[model samples]
Target chain A: MSAQRRAQVLLAILAVALIVLPFVSGSYVLSVATLILFFAFTGQAWNVMMGFAGQLSLGHSLYVGLGAYAAAGLFFHYGIGPWAGVWLAIALCVVAGAVIGFLAFRFGISGVYFALLTIAFAEFTRIGFDHITWLGGAAGLFIKVEQRDTWDLLNLRGTPKMFYFVMLALAAGAFAFCTWLLRSRAGYYWQAIREDEDAAQALGINTFRWKMLAVVISAAMTGVAGVFYAFYYNNLFPEQTYHISRSIEIILGPIIGGLGTLFGPILGAAVLTILADSITEIMAAAGIEVPGVKQVFYGLCLLVVIMFLPNGIWPAIARRLGLKDK
Target chain B: MSAVNGSPILEVRELDLYYGDAQALDGVTLAASEGEIVAIVGSNGAGKSSLIRTIAGIETQRRGMVRFRGQDIGGLPSHRVCELGIGQVPEGRQVFPSLTVRENLEMGAMLRRARARLAQTLEEIFELFPRLKERERQPAGTLSGGEQQMLAIGRCLMGQPELVMFDEPSLGLAPTIVQEVFHTIRRLHERGLTIILVEQNVAVSLKLAQSAYVLENGRIAMNGTGAELLADDRVRQAYLGL
Candidate 1:
């Protein structure tokens, strides 16, 4: 099939999945699905820079926490709806991401140093938030609870089905945005810079500006996911929301699925999340309890995936299915 | 006021360049006129790349004046310097490896052209390098060394540059490929493009350029018309080895 046809088919399948997911799931399953969708959304955002643009960010949770905190703090203080908070969250993330992107690229900090800088920024943000009592500090802040029904769309305190659907929408949006960016001129610029920045510059690509664009867009999308996470979980703690583990969880999908490949993040998320749940179930069934087994599993999964399938599972599957690159 | 021809398309005066306390280029003066092919030949560590890079604005000169079209561009950024109509086919044929032959060419016009003219420019580049047209969608990295070199040259031409500098255009290639590249360079010259070529391969560059300069130990060891240098006993002994 042509690239357009293939993209259309993949998108159609994803649309069908999003529409059908919440109805088939139980409350607990729906909750897990909601989390999965949120991670997938954020993962796609991170993938835009790290995977496609080749500006690997290890501090992606900075944007996530910023988005979540921005929206959550606004809503908590002003009773603003999730719909309104989303924009502010995204805008804030964009500005922050642009700043970080500019500093790194302007100074020519690339490769592992760029990754370290991102991590450092997120850590700094976490520390700042931990002491900021306005957002409930380390204990975290929760929305006000009254006798409202679980389907409070305005308050964003909805049923598992509601959260699942909202998360599905955000995830779909991210996937679509990534698809468009990858296929568009902007995508070409990003990919070119990612492959070889100096060559990109020689080609007259303003590497600084384009990289900033990637950082900002990716950041804005991740921020929106933070808003989604805040509403879905109804709480935000510095450690939990801004944790490095969250950053790792967000990137694993893109890394395992296929860095720079559309649908890679979604597939990676589905694979990693489902396999993780199944592993826990198998462990429980065998009555073999292991300390921090889940963390070990996540690490091992990343390690094994990187060691064997570095380019990603999607490319392997795509090749197996006789699908050539566009 | 150069006595021989049109105003200098590029001029570097009293250029001094250093790489971490090691003076690479010292008091070098050079000028390239419109429609002229000027070659700079030097052996390894003889400051040829440094001179070209300093002129290209990729490396800063501590003391010098670089003017393009009579405008001082010494302080300009590399991309801006390129936007001022200076295109560089850098050392190592550094094409965007993951991009297609077409996309790599598209990047060359990224400075001042639009999406509308991109198709026209792409076709022009394909016309300039037919091998690229054959593999427009193939990853540049996957191309043979000769094809990659063609793609690199085609990419630089897409900018429609007033002045183009090719650094070691024949580096690390088969003799046939090298000949093909020089032939392309000759063809490009026939089309009235200004070029400044930096090379360690002295004989070939001397044959192609109208005027040439030889750099040795951070200074100009020789400078004259290509025929004059070719006849010089020093150039013949050192570079041509005849």
Candidate 2:
């Protein structure tokens, strides 16, 4: 078979496997699969800004925390449903993204400076949330969980299997959206800007507008992930949600898989989540209570990937498989 | 209408630029008439590139006006300036490195004016550079310097610009490729592109230009017909080594 056909068949098989996975697995394995899909979705969102548009954002947790709080706050206080609250979350995140994008791009802050600015904004938001006593602040916010035998899709309160399917849908939907985006006009403009801003400008691309668009879209997509996070986890904490470590976790999948490719983030998330979970399980079984062992494993994986696959594992894998990536 | 009857297609008046308290261009003024080749010759750091950058709207002019077809375009963004139909082949062939040659050309036709006839423009570009067509799928970075230059010029032309600016088109190129570049510029002039040619190859630019300006220390030191400046003693002493 041709390489393209082989790739298509491989994709089909993978799709079938994911769809049937929850049925064959226990609750623990199902939860891990859901976690992998969550990371894959968020990683793709972050990839739009840094990988495609060449704008590095080291503090993407700012959006996630903001989205989570905005939706969770409304849902907690006014008794609004999560489905209705998600739009508010998206709007809030887009506004935040616009503020950051305008300040950075309009004033000519780029590269490491841009990355630093994102972190600063996220840190400021985290600190501000800590002081705001109404939304539980640093003490954390909790959602009222009810015991129900039936599925509640509208409220996002359901069995573990239902949450897993929803997350799977989200991951699949994001993948499809990114695929369309990469082939769209904005996608070409983003890649052009990423390659060289000056050259893109000379070719009649409005660099500032396009860069802002990338951030807005990326922020909105990440907002959806935040909604999922808030609903599934049933709680929100400023310390845990908006921390720099959370932002690092969101970006790690894309970095380890591949920066700009479609399937790289998904592969990276699956590999990282499965391995990390397995290690944690093994350590527990052996009665070895090592602190931050998961983090150490992640660091080791990153080191190995950077040393052996500088372009990330996806490109090397694609090359070997004769699949067109890019 | 005014542009058709022998008025300048691009005009710069008393332009000035500075970089952190250092003046790079001082009161530099020049014009390129429609269907004319205007060569700008200067030594290193004489603000030749700065002038082109300012006209292309990459650099903001500190104190002067840049008019395109009598429209004041000073201080506009680079993309807005481009959409107004001014195209540039930048100093070093800055084609999108990882993009395929065809994709690079496609990026140029992204302007609204050029978008409607993208296929036609692509065909014309391929016809203009058969080698580019031959290597359509190859990454631009993998191409040789001369081929990359052709791709740059082709990319610029894909915008369907009424006027095109060339900035040191022959820099870092092999001798034969330099000749090929000059030949392409001459062909483009014949095809009715109002040309602004900036070059260090003094004699050849003057020979190809209808009018030319000599810039020194961010100022217009001399202005005359190409032949007049080519034969002048000061021009010969400073740039030509004659």
Candidate 3:
């Protein structure tokens, strides 16, 4: 078969497997799959800016935290449903992204400095949220989970199975969106800018405007993930949600899977989450209590992946399977 | 003020450029008329590339005016300048290395003027450089130096630009490839496109150009017909060893 045909067959198989997963698996496996999907969605969001546009943002957790707070604060206090509150979350994240993009792109701060600016903004938001007592401040905000027999899909309150499907839908939606973007004019322009900004400008691409658009779109998408995170976990803590470590975890999927490819983030998320979960489970069964074991495992995985497959696991797999990686 | 004279397509007046505290261009003034080739010949660090970059809007001038077809275009971004029909085949043949040759060519036709004629233009370009057609699916990075330079020039042409700036078009190419590049430039001129040619091969550039300027220490040292400059003793001593 041709590479494209082989890739299509593989995609069909993967889709069928994911769709039937919750039917055959128990609740534990369902929760892990949901976590994998959540990371995949967020990772795809972060990938657009860094992978496609070559703007590295190390503080994507800022958008996720902001989106969670905006939606959860409304749902918790004003009794607004997440479906309604998600728009506010998206807007909040877009504004924040614009501010950062403007400050960085307009002022000619790029590369590592731009990344530092993102981290600084996340840190500032985290510290600011810590003092806001109305939303429970640093003590953490809790959403009262009512015992409901029926699955609430609209309000985003559902069992592990429902949440798994929701997350799957999210990842699939992001994949479709990114696929469309990669084939669009903006996608071509973004790749050109990523390859060489000066050359892209010489060819009539408005690098600044397109770069801002990338950040805005990425932030808006990340906000949706935030809304799902708040409702699924039933709690929001600034320290846990906005932490730099959380940002790292979100990006790890894309970096390990494939930076710019459509399926990289999802594959990376699945591999990392499953392996991490399995290792943790094994440790628990052995009755060993280790601090920062998850972080250490992630670091080791990154190192191993970088050493073996410098381009990421997905590209290697794609090459072997005669698939188009990007 | 120039030998090959017509209505000026591009005009640079009293252009001053600075990098940090050091000045790169000082009171540099030149113009290229419609349907003629203008050669800029100077030694390394004489600011030929800087002048081309400034006119292309890649580098902002500290002071002075860059007018295209009698309209002031100073302070406009590079993309805006490109949209207004200024194209540049920048120094070092800066092709998108990872992209396929065809994709790189497609990137060039991004201008509104070029978009409508993309297919026609691609056909013409393939006819002009058959090797590009042969390597259409190959990554540009894998191409030979001559091929990459052709790709760069082809990319600039893809923008459907009326005025294309050639910066060191012959730099680092083999002798035969340099001949091919100059031949392409000559053919491009014959097609009614005005050209701004910068070259390290002073003798050949002057021979091909109608009017020429010798830039020294960021200032125009001599401005005349290519023949006059070629025959001048000072030009021969400084740029040409003859």
Which model is ahead, 1 or 3, in terms of TM-score?
3
lDDT tens digits, residue span A255-297, model 2: 9999988888998999999999999999999999999999999
Candidate 3 lDDT over residue span B110-195, tens digit each = 88878999999999999999999999999999999999999999999999999999999999999999999999999999999999
Task: Please write out the lDDT profile of model 1 over residues B1-242, one tens digit for every residue.
Answer: 23278788888898889888999889898888888899999899899888877877777898989999899999677878888888888889998887788888887777674345777878888887778999988889999988888988988888878788899999999999999999998888888889999987888899898888989998987888877888999998988889
* lDDT (Cα) of model 1: 0.84
Query: Who is ahead in DockQ, 2 or 3?
Result: 2
lDDT score for residue A19 of model 1: 84
What digit string (tens of lDDT, one per residue) describes model 3 on residues A1-326? 99999988988999999999999999899999999999999999999998888899999999999899888999999999998999999999999999999999998899999999999999989999999998889999988886445589878886788888889999999999999998899899999999888889888888999999999999999999999999989899999889999999999999999898888999999999999999999999999989889999999999999999988999999888878866
**Which lDDT tens digits does candidate 2 get at residues B1-242?**
11343888888889999987999999988888899999999999999999998888888988999999999999999898999999999889899999999999999999988999999999998998899999999999999999999999999999999999999999999999999999999999999999999999999999999899999999999988789999999999999998
Query: For residue A298, what is the lDDT in candidate 2?
Result: 93
